[model samples]
Target: MNDYLKNGLFLAAGVAIGALGAVALGKGKFSIRPAMADLLSHGMDLKEKTATVLERAKENLDDLMAEAKHAKESREGKSVAEGETA
Candidate 1:
């Protein structure tokens, strides 16, 4: 009987502590001003635009590399022909 009473009291104390902790750690309200919201949206748009520019730059770089490779092959072929003639 005494053991049961002690156990019940412990359980009640644990429940009360948990409830208090939950209330203290709950999230509060959040609000953003209209000007700040517009700024944030504009920033996101700029990031998307920058990403598109970088993608185009990467494609241009690839094309340049292909052209350079072709040019190098042509130069090597010419050098080989000159060597044979010599």
Candidate 2:
């Protein structure tokens, strides 16, 4: 009888601890509502910042390509002049 009682008490404590853990980890509805809201807000802000950075990168890439083309044309002209003199 005493052994049975001890077993019952241990089982009950285990169940209570498990319940508390589940609640703390947001397993139940309404448990993690505030955390979810914060995550969504931060995600939105991150997306906006990422888009802005992408736009700036695109503009910089275009400028670099134009500069490269200009440099290539100048080099070609110099080569042609050298060939004519030789």
Pick the TM-score winner.
2
For each candidate, give its TM-score against the true structure. 0.55, 0.57
* lDDT to native, each model: 0.87, 0.92
For 1-86, candidate 2 gives per-residue lDDT tens digits of 69999999999999998798687776564567787689889999999999999999999999999999999999999999999999
lDDT of model 2 at position 4: 94
CA-RMSD of model 1: 17.1
Flag regions of model 2 displaced more than 4 Å: 1-26
Model 1 steric clash pairs? none
Error of 1 at 52 (Å): 0.6
**Tens digit per residue, CA lDDT, model 1, 32-73:** 356557988999999999999999999999999999999999
Candidate 2: residue 83 lDDT (0-100): 100
